[model samples]
Target chain A: MKYYNWGIIGLGEIATSFTNSFQQENSQITAVASRTLSKAVAFANEHDIPKAYGSFEALLADQAIDIVYIAVPNRQHIEHILKALAAGKHVLCEKAITMNSAELTQAMTLAEEKGLILAEAMTIFNMPLYQELRSQIDSNRFGKLKMIQAPFGSYKEPDPSNRFFNPDLAGGALLDIGTYAVSFARWFFTSQPKVIASVMQPFSTGVDEQSATILQNDVQEMATVSLSFQAKMPKQGVVAFEDAYIVINEYPRADEAKIFFNDGTVETIVSGDSTQALNYEITNMIKMIEGETSNRSLFLTKDVIDLLDQMQQNWTN
Target chain B: MKYYNWGIIGLGEIATSFTNSFQQENSQITAVASRTLSKAVAFANEHDIPKAYGSFEALLADQAIDIVYIAVPNRQHIEHILKALAAGKHVLCEKAITMNSAELTQAMTLAEEKGLILAEAMTIFNMPLYQELRSQIDSNRFGKLKMIQAPFGSYKEPDPSNRFFNPDLAGGALLDIGTYAVSFARWFFTSQPKVIASVMQPFSTGVDEQSATILQNDVQEMATVSLSFQAKMPKQGVVAFEDAYIVINEYPRADEAKIFFNDGTVETIVSGDSTQALNYEITNMIKMIEGETSNRSLFLTKDVIDLLDQMQQNWTN
Candidate 1:
C-alpha cells in the first residue's frame, strides 16, 4: 500500500500533462526538472511539486525519486534513459521509446542488470478497454484475429524546421505519430510480425511525411499501417476477426470500442476513463515497480520499433 | 432518344437483377438466353421478355437486340463479349471484365473495328453520388486530394466448390469483390495508378482469399485497397483532401456520403438512390449507345483490371 513518487524531465507539453496527474490516488509527483532553473521552478510552482532541479542529472540523482519519466525529444530518449537507469531510477519514457531496437535492447539490458523496471508510456499498452476486449476474444466468441488496420495521420504545417519534419530531432510521421498505430497493431498480434511490403513518401526535409506498409506473421495475421503528416486521418484502429470486428476510433487512449458482429449486431464495450490515461500508465508502472507484474508491453514496444525500422528502410534503398 | 433493345446472355442471379430494371423509363430488356432452354424460357416468362434463346449465339444473332448485357462468370466474359460484338451488338459485361489486360485489350480492339460500344457493369462507374463528389473536388473548395482507402470484405461461407474459391470459375476475393474497391479508388484518381506494393493469401482451393495492395499514380495520389472473403468489412471508401474527407459507406453503389471537415463539421451528401443502382447502369449504357456521351468510366474499369492483374501476380511469383 505505497504511493510512488515520480520525477519528470524535459518540461514540454506532454511533461506538463504528466504532472497534471499528481492528484490521482496512489500518485505523488514530487520533482520536476529542466535545463533552465527558472523554467523548472515555474513548472514546479504551477504543479505545486515539492522540488525542482535545473538539470536532469540533479533530479535523477535524487534518492527519493522512484520513477524518472523522460519526455525528451525522440533523438534524446536513449541518452536520457541510459543516464536515468545508471542513476538508479526506474524509467518510464515517452513513445517511440528509442530510435531503434538496438538502443532499446541496450536500455532493457541495463534495466535488467540494475534490477529496475522500464516501460513506455504508450497508451494502447496501458488502456483497460483493450484488456477487456482481449479477454473477450480469448473467450472464443470473437473468433480468430484475421486483419488489422491502424492509420494515424496528422496535418502539420509545411515547416521544415519543426520537430515533425526535422532530421536532427529524429522526426517523421513514423516516430511522432505512426508509433501509436504500430503499437495498436502489435498489441493484438499473437507473435512478432514482419514487414513484408512497404512504401514511403518523403517530406521537403527528406524525412517520411507519409507511408503505407503491410505486415504479416507466421500465423497469417495481416496488418496495414498508413501514416501521413501532410494530411489528416482519423486515429481509427480496427482489429477484424472471424466472427466479429472491433472498431476503436481515436484509439491512442480510447475507453470505448464497438464490436460489429457478422450477424448485423453491435455491442458497445466501455472500460476505464480517457481522462485517466496518464494516471493509468503511472498506476501500471507502479505495479511493475512493486513486483506485482512485469513490463510485458515492452515486447510490443520492441516489435513496433522494429517495424518502424523496416518501414523507413524502404526509403533509404 | 431511343431506349436500346437489350438482350441478356447468361441468366444468372445478376442478370435477374438487371432485368428487374425494366420498369425504368429508359430500359428495354427484351430477350434472355441460357445454356438450358428451360431456364431461358423460365427467365423470359418471369420477366415478361418477348424472346428466349437456347444458346448465346442465337441471342447474339437476333437483329432486334441492339445491346447485349453479358452476365456470365468472370472466365466467360471475353468469349461472350467478342461474340456479341461480332454480331454488331453493344456489349455490357460483368466486372473483372476479362481475366487480364490482354483479353480486355483484344475485346476493345474488335469493338472499335466494328464501331460498337463495350463497357463493364461496374456500379462505381455509374453511381451518381460519386459523380457529384468528383465535381466537388474539381471545384477546388475541397482542396487537393491526398489519400484514399477503399476496403471491401465479405464473409462468404468457406465452401471450396462455390465460386469464391473455385479456380475453375475464376474465383477469388480480388476478382469478385475486390473489383468494387479497386474501381472505387480509380474513380477519383487523376490518372492511371501502378501497384506499388501488394501481398495475397490464397484459400485452400489456391484462389486468392484475401489481399492488401498499395497504389500510387503520377500525381502522387496514394490508395490502399484491402479485400477479404473470410471477413465482413464495410465497403467504406474514403477520399481524403486538404480541407475535408468524404466517407462513402457501402461505396460500391453508395447513394450518400458524409464529408468530415478539419474544422469539426460534418456535411451529408445524398445524390442517387441505392435501390436504382442497376437502373443507373442501364441508363448510363444507353447514354453511351446514343453517342451523346462516351463510356468514360471504362477508363477506370480498365485501370482497375490492370491493378488486379498486378495484385494476383504477387501470388504466382
Candidate 2:
C-alpha cells in the first residue's frame, strides 16, 4: 500500500470536516497552513497534524508533503492550485474548480502537462451509492434511462460578510450547491446537453440566491436541477428510467438509495457508512496520484463548470 | 344539505375516475354522455347512473342535471365547457381547461356571464391534505415560505394511437402531468409569476414528453416544476420555508403530509382518507354551485394556463 501525506491550505470550516478522511492508516494530514500562524498552529494541534505553516508558500515548499488539498474561497482556488502545481504537488481542490470553463481548462491543461493528478473534491462523485447507481444505469437495471431530477438548497442568511453572499468571492448558489446537481446530470447522461434553459432570482450582491436549470440531450434524456440558499432543501437526487427510478437522499454524501419499480416493488440499497462518506474520494485521489488510475473527477468537474458557464450565458442572452 | 346531480360529457378513463368523488352523500352522477350510444349505455350501467345519452347535446339538454363535468379530450375542453355554460349548467371540467390561456379566458368568461360555477376538476386543488398544508403555510407553521417544488411523471409508451402522443388531441406532458405542478405553484404564490422559463423534450409525434419549468414571483419566491410521460416519478411535492419544510407524496390525491423542522423534529399529518381523496374536490364543486363560495379554482386555473403558454412562446422564440 502506498502511503499518502497531505498538506492542507486554508483552514476553514470545511477543512475541519475534511480531516475525517485522513482517519485511515495509509492517509495522514501531515501539515496544515493558514494565513495566521496562530490559526495554523491551533488547527494542527487539534487535528494531530505534525507540521503547521504560517504561510501557504511555506507549506508548498515542504518537500515531505506529497499532496495539497486547497480549501480556500472560490476566487483563490485557481491561484492556490496553480501555485501548488508549480511546487510539484498533486492537488485535490474544492468544488467549482474555477470561475468559468476557460479558467478550468487552463488549470487542467497545466496539470496534464506536468503529469500530476488534479482532481476536484466533489464527494458525491465518489460516494459508493452514486457509483452503484451509475453501474446499474449502465447495466440497464432500470431499463432505458429517461429523466433525472436533483434539487439542493440551504437556508443561508443574507449576511454580506459571509462568502456565500459575497459577489467578489464568486459566491452564489450555482458555484456552490448547483455544481453537485449539474454534476449528477453530466455523469448520468455522459453527453453534453443539447439545450440549457435557466432563470435566477438575483441577490443584492448581484449573485443568484435561487436558480432553476433544465438540461436536455439529443437522446431525449433530461435533467432538472434547482438550487437555492433561501430554503431548507432535502438535497435529494433522482434518476428515472422507463421501468423504475432511484432516489438518493442527501446525495452529496449519499449512503442510502431507494429504488421503486413499475411493478410496485421497492428496494433499498445501503452502501458505505455515512460518517465515512468522504473516505472513498480521498482514496480515489491517492490512486490518481500513484498513477494506478487517471482522475475521472477532473473531466466531470470540467463538464459541470462548462455547463454552468453556458447556462449563465444563456440567461443573459 | 344540498344535493348535486352531475351530468358527464364524455365516457373516458378520467370520467370513470371522476365518478369516485360522487361516492360521498349529497353528490350523485345522475347522467352521462358519449358519442357512441353503446359506450354511454355501458358506462352508465356500470356506474349505476340513472340516465345515459348517446350525444353530448342530449346530456346538456337534461334539465335535472345541476352540473356537467367535462371529461373530453383536452382540445375539446373549451368547446364542451362553453356548450355546458350556454345550457345553463354549472361546469367542472377536467384539468387543462383549454388549448391555451386565450381559450381558457373565453371559456371562463362564458361561465361568469352565465353565473355558473365553472372550475377545473384538479383533484389536488381540493384534497384535504393540500387545504391543511395551505392553512399551515398561512399560519406560518413552517415560517416564511421561500420555495415550492412539485414533480410528476409517468411511463407512457409512445403509441401513436394513444392520446398521450397525439398532437390533435392536445396531448403532451404539459396538458396532462404539467398542469398539476403548475397549478400548485399558482395556488401557493397567489399572483401571476413575473418570470417563466422552461425546456421540453418532444416525442416522435411532436408533442412534448417531458418538460421542466421555473416560475418566480416578485418577492423572490420561486417554484420549479418538472413533468414527464417518459419516466415513473414519485409524484411528491415539497414546500420549503426558512425553518422547516412540508413534503406531500402522491400529490395529486395527497392524504398525508410530513413536516420536517430544522430542529430534527418531524410531524406527520394525515387529512382525508386516501381512498376518498377525490371527495373533497367534489364537495367543493357542489359548494361552488350552491353560491356558498366563488370558484377559486377558476382563477388559479387561468394563471397556470397563462404561465404554460408564456413558457412555450418563450421556447419557440
Highest-lDDT candidate: 1
lDDT of 1 by residue, A1-317 (tens): 67778899999999988877645577688899999999999998988889999999999889999889999888899999999999999999999899998999999999999998999999889879988887888888887788888887788888999899999988889998989989999988888899988888888898888888888898888888888887788788888887888899899989999999999999999998988888888888988888886779887888899988888787687
Query: Candidate 2, B302: how far from true, in Å?
Result: 1.1
Q: Please, what are the lDDT tens digits per residue for candidate 2 over residues B1-317?
A: 67778899988887887785566577789999999989999998998999999999999999999889898888898889999999999888888878899998888788779888888888777877777888888887777777888888898876976989888888889888888888877777846785467777788898888877778887777788888898889888888888888888887877898988877799999998767755676888887777787777788888888888987786677
Give me candidate 2's TM-score against the actual structure.
Answer: 0.95
Off by over 4 Å in 1: none
Whole-model lDDT per candidate: 0.87, 0.84
Q: For candidate 1, lDDT tens digit of each residue in B1-317? A: 76678899999899988887655576678899999999999999988999999999999999999999999888999999999999999998989899999899899899999989999999888979988988888898677777888888888899999988899999899989988989999998888889988888789999888888888888778888888888877677888887788888899888999998888899999998988888888888888888878879777787888888888776677
All models, DockQ values?
0.67, 0.72
Tell me the TM-score of each prediction against the true structure. Answer: 0.98, 0.95
Clashing pairs in model 2, backbone N/Cα/C closer than 3 A: none
Error of 2 at B145 (Å): 2.8
